[model samples]
Target: MKATRQLHDLGQSLWLDNITRSLLDDGTLARYIAEDSITGLTSNPSIFDAAIGGGDAYDAGIHAKTLAGLSGEALFTELALEDLRRAADLFRPVFDATGQVDGWVSMEVSPLLAADSAGSIAAARHIHHQGRRDNLFVKIPGTPEGVPAIEEAIFLGIPINVTLLFSCAQYQAVAEAYLRGIERRLAAGLDPRVGSVASLFISRWDVAANPQLPDALRNQLGIAVGQQTYRAYRELLASKRWHKLAAAGARPQRLLWASTGVKDPSAPDTLYVSALAAPDTIDTIPEKTLHAFADHGQLHGVLADDGGDADAVLAQIAAAGVDLDALALKLQRDGAAAFVKSWQQLLQRIADKASALEKESQLP
Candidate 1:
């Protein structure tokens, strides 16, 4: 059996951290679902920028939207919804079979609104409504500003993927926000089964800290952080608050391991995938990492419910001059900034393509 299937059987969801028109048009995404057990997908500005700008696959759509008086973020969202809706339909079976626990496709709100909670909430609602799919999640960052927006959006019944988180504390904060949203819904006599996921980034931790650490400590920070967060996730699920919510038909806002792709070429390609295998959690991996793992990955075991040696390892990392708290904040800020840059670049790419297409049309 392929390692992907084994991972799925072990109860860890494998979601492709990518989406492009070509993947859908060529049946690649469908094949991943049918064969590789990829039950879900997640996308961001970077992924969309690459997908839209990397090739001609999105040109016709961009041109059409441009002619339809849509440009910039408005144009981009339409194109993205086009792709996600198709991907969502492809995974509809898994969604139905698993009862909405699996087969989710995520679309992030404008990264420009990372600090504007109100704007973020509005964009999330618009995207969720526009997506028109039950399995779709509108991604919101887990930054301080974004936490309240997450709570508000969840209360409004929009499923969310809380992104840009880098620490256990960040994950806990967003999880609490999700709970608050659910509690508010229950109070309002609304359905409490609002699906959500707190996405804790993994590899970026090592990417930021590896340069400051010795060889023995290299590529280990991310896994240790993941272990620590996983422990907290298990504890939260077992808590009285979560139990009450669960008893009230509220789904646990799952812990998701994001940025699982190995950043260092020296590290094992499957390092994050194999080490962070835990049931009831989701790992969204890049296409390269997904194929690499399916080809040669091995799962030693799942993460320790108690976090194993994560605390000790993190202490050692701190002693090595890495401040975990500050770094976590830095990573989240840097990630949000990076997405904004990508979002701007994506709009520019669409504008450039549309201009060229307009000129072509004018050429008798």
Candidate 2:
């Protein structure tokens, strides 16, 4: 059996952290679904920027949308919804087989609204309503502003992929937001089992903190953080609060490992994928890493529910002068900024493509 199938049987999901028109048109996504057990997908402005800016796949679509008077965010949203709808349809069978617990596709809200709770909420509602796919997860950052938006969106029955979470503490914040949202749903006599996932970035910790630590500690911080958060996740799953919510038909907000692509080439290509393998969580991996793992990844063993030696590793790093709390905040802020940069670049790519397509049409 493929290693990807092994991970699935272990009860963890493998979601592709990518989307593009070519991926959908060329049957690559479908092939992954069949051969590699890619049950779902996730997308952000950076991925879209790479897809649109990197090729002419979207030129005709942008031109047509431009003709329809859509520009800027509107044009981008329409394009994204098209791709997400296709991806969601492809995963619909998995959605049915898993009874709606899996088989999902995620599209992020405007990064411009990362700090605007009201704006984020409005954009989420608009995006979800327009996408019209029940399996689509509208991603919102878990920033202070975004936490409330997650709750509000969930209360209204929107499936949310809470992004940009860094530490166990940050995960706790959004986990509570999810809980509060479900509690409100129960209060309103609505089903509280709306799907949600709190994404904790993995490889970025090594990318950000490795330079400040000893060479022996290289490429280990991220996995340590994963262990820390996994402990929190197991604890939450076993908590009385979760049990009460479960009784009311509320599902647990799944823990997702984002940024699983290895930043250190010296590290194993499947570094994060193997080290962080745990059941009941999700790992949304980049295409490169996904294929690498399918070919050669091994699940050494599942993470310890009590967090194993994560505390010792973290303490050693802390003693070496790493301020994890402060670093977590910085990573979250940097991530939000990076998305904003990508969002602007994607919009410009759309505008440029639309213009070029129109000029080509004007050529007699």
lDDT of 2 by residue, 13-72 (tens): 999999999999999999999999999999999999999887888888888899999999
lDDT tens digits, residue span 1-364, model 1: 9999999999999999999999999999988988899999999999999998788999889888888899988999999999999999999998899878999999999999999999999999899889999999999999999999999999999999999999999998998999999999999999998889999999999988999999999988999999999999999999999899999999989899999998899889999999999999999989999999989999898888999999999999999999999999999999999999999998898889999999998998
Question: Which regions of candidate 1 deviate over 4 angstroms?
Answer: none
Candidate 2 has an lDDT of 0.94
Alpha carbon lDDT of each predicted model? 0.93, 0.94
Please give the range of 10 consecutive residues that has the lowest summed lDDT in model 1: 53-62
Candidate 2 regions with alpha-carbon error over 4 angstroms:
none
